[model samples]
Target: MLTLTATPVLDVEPAIHGEGPTWDAARRELVWVDIDAGQVRRATVSPAGVVAEVGIHPGGGTVGFVVPSSDGGWLLGADGGFTHLSADGAATVLLALEGEGPAAGTRMNDGAVDPAGRVLGGTMALDETPGAGSLYRVDLDGSVHVVLRDLTISNGIEWTADGRTVYLADSGAAEIRAHDYDIATGEFGGSRVFLDLSSDDGPPDGLTMDDEDHVWVALWGAGQVRRYSPAGELVAVVRVGAANTSSCAFAGPGLDHLVISTSTQGLDEAARAAQPDAGRLFVVRPGVTGRPAGVYRGPVDALHRAE
Candidate 1:
């Protein structure tokens, strides 16, 4: 397998816990979340791997993931549930995830916009309690549905180009699961183990797919991102100087550069000191390109009524 090293993007600020990295094709910007800081950051990335901050939106509480909507607003998985952050910076809670099914102790985690324009997000307990997480899907019409239950820590989420298959990482379980998906109905069929890392490098945090259909997964504590073939063969490894590598996305104008987000969330003082670039964003050219990220087409006007 091929191995490569990633370099930090010196222009960006380090996030306390950077988790989700997404490419917004419509605006030609890179969007990601600093979960612990409750911030959604937007930036412009050059093909040569330089990042310039554009805007920062504060979500009141922990912001897990953010996706641009076709309605000019942005939808995000925040502390309560799916929220709408209007273009003018107004916050509207579309659905309250806690108290109905998940307990108040739980908060939304990583999520992604599906090909059908719906948003699928998962939740986990703040304290990382086992079996206290679940995945949910929000349709374009503002309806919510539970996708999966009994998950420990729901992290990375991605889908095949055809939207017939989905891969989700249950980090606490140290495994990623692949499920048969239906874009027409936004439902999931049988799911099976896609990648088991219980005894491997590290727990899977976030992941993305390239044009070749290979999945690249970030290893939380292993300081690396790994690429695997569609048939589950290890093909390449991208090493980062930071041990808490969180997530990655194919960004840049040509989508040729892989933008990675790291963290210092669980590191001790000494460990944090050893890795000076722990929370900085990193980039590397992998000779591969990814398609434009999925955007949420859900309506937000009705969300205000629900709030």
Candidate 2:
């Protein structure tokens, strides 16, 4: 179901399982990960329709997520939990997640920086076992906590511009959920379903929010990205050429241009042949601006050791 009519293909990164696409405004670069391929990429992007790979992640174990560091380097989520990746590829293991550290089959998945500059990392079982995933957060004061547990296929985790609401996607449930959040305290209230995808439309994967309070979500097997209003009403839909549109982030000037990451993980040869753009990057201007991706303002000393 690859259809590109108005939006243009931005980069042909051709990642095997492109999962996280984030815009590092401080560095003015687009950073994303190829999870299955165990790689990371930094791209220089321009509104003039130019995108180039400027750097690479130190390749080794499975790398799932990456975001810019206010201090420098990358806040990385990979095997055995979170770490900091320096410019020279040296990694400093920060937090050893609960299940990941014990070789218990769980791996770090998607994550987002909270308004207070802490990271909320999610976990998923390598076997996709039900109720094996959880969402954990690292606070500014060097506290690591499991805010939510018993999740399956936990994917995107983002917050509203005002930081009053948090949105989480559990692909196994085929829905996006929202929670009341305390920006200063990093607390979460009970959540309710924000949007539920029809079983046939595919599961909701990763998502991002725009300044106008719209949440844009990628559909893993549906070959489309959908935008929803704050009230949970569908606003728009953009068809991507790939069935595995894993995640997306707003990039470029004003954070209005959407940079998408796709995956070729489960595609067989025939499926791959039908969708040639399955693993390339796609960009579209959706007429909305997103908040800047958050960076860690937490005590740097806390990131030096595992909790």
Maximum-TM-score candidate: 1
Q: Candidate 1 lDDT, tens digit per residue, 1-307?
A: 8999999977788999997899988888998999999898889998787899988888748889988889776888988687888876677777676453234788899999999999999998888889988988888787787888999999999998878999999999999999999989899999999999999989999999999889999999999999999888999999999999999999989999999999999899999989989988999999899877798987875532123
lDDT of 2 by residue, 90-131 (tens): 777776765563378877889989888888888888888888
Candidate 1 — which pairs collide? none
Give the range where candidate 2 is weakest over 10 consecutive residues by summed lDDT. Answer: 1-10
Question: TM-score of model 2 relative to the true fold?
Answer: 0.93
Best by lDDT: 1
Tell me model 1's lDDT, rounded to 2 decimals: 0.88
lDDT of each: 0.88, 0.80
Q: What's the alpha carbon RMSD for model 2?
A: 2.6
Candidate 1 residue spans exceeding 4 A from truth? 100-103, 303-307
After TM-score superposition, what is the CA distance of residue 97 in candidate 1 from its true location, in Å?
Answer: 1.6
Off by over 4 Å in 2: 1-11, 198-200, 299-307
Query: How badly does each model clash, as a count of residue pairs?
Result: 0, 1
Q: What lDDT is reached at residue 121 by model 1?
A: 91
